[model samples]
Target: MNHEKLITLPCQYPEEAKNSFKKLIFEEAYLLFIVLGTGETVNKILDLATKAAGSNQDPGMVIWITDYTVVSDIIESLNDPLNKLNDLDNTYAFALSIIDKVVDVIKKDENKLDILRIWKSFQLALKG
Candidate 1:
């Protein structure tokens, strides 16, 4: 595929084209065809992740306050409340913060795409 032509393939609508390509390829692979595809789900997640990332240029500067401050300013507010959930390890806190960003904590990549394809197939098979 020529680079110029390939780039223009989605000049105006990249995501719509990508999802269409995923559906076509998954359902009509040369060697094997998948019964179902989760490209849409993955795309939605990716969109949310992008929005979350763009909305926070400097997330560290985000204002932190107690939800109950309105009820009682006396209560000591922990800016890093997630720290309490996983005191032993902060990985959960890190992940939780990501999840808090509009239910988007992860992005799909090539590796996850393959897994999503198989998982979608399994889900469909189970439904039947």
Candidate 2:
């Protein structure tokens, strides 16, 4: 994997990040979709992230941040008077939505101490 290249993919905006992700997926056809398309389960996604991080994809960095963090970072980086994410890609929007749902589930789980704990458990389960 090309760590430098993937690490350089801008996460400041949704459009750029999505385009970069799409580019990487296209270039490394066997990196993500290869595993995801199969019935590899959640580990496939985590494995892809690790593989991409080892390469130039920086999937770990992308997945590490929470939905609120991503939104805050994007908003804070903006200079326009109206801080809107209208230019973000559909993939980013979809990701945020999924994270939102995960957040909701964690909220109702009652067993988890916090989001970080939930995330850790989720990762461990995937690894297992």
Candidate 3:
């Protein structure tokens, strides 16, 4: 994994914002790992992903914070030579792309400022 790139990705944001973003990313990734580890069929995983994303709150957040060891394990699994968990990487990439498109749509909307404000507030809450 590109650790340098991951560490620098949120550098443009404020310190607190960067931390929160990192935490959120980790939480979501861990959640993805759990879902993928279930070894479900592709259709089932897709359905679970949709439900997880749409839920009022992420079930994974119940764990409060993820451990460093867990993060390391996730990275190792993704980097495994056997490509056993490649779907996890692909699903994560696809999810991020979808999020990027959604954000682009929101950016072009007239209520972008309002939406951004709400998102910022949400991020602040997450940080705490």
Best by lDDT: 2
Each candidate's lDDT (Cα)? 0.25, 0.31, 0.29
The worst-scoring run of ten residues by lDDT in candidate 3 lies at 97-106
lDDT of 2 by residue, 1-128 (tens): 32232233344576665555445433432212111111233233334444433334322232322233334444333332332333332112112121211111122213434335434433432332
Candidate 2 Cα deviation (angstroms), residue 24: 1.3
The TM-score measured for candidate 3 stands at: 0.21
Model 1 lDDT, full chain set: 0.25
Q: Model 1: per-residue lDDT, tens digit, 16-122?
A: 44444333323422111111112455334333323332222222111111121131211122223423222211111011122121111122333453435333322
Whichever of 2 and 3 has more TM-score, that candidate is: 2
User: Which residues of candidate 1, in runs, are more than 4 Å off?
Assistant: 1-38, 60-128
Better of 1 and 2 by lDDT: 2
Q: What is the clash count for each candidate, in the order shown? A: 0, 7, 0
Worst 10 residues of 2 by lDDT: 94-103
Clashing pairs in 2: 1-55, 2-55, 2-56, 3-55, 3-56, 6-56, 6-57
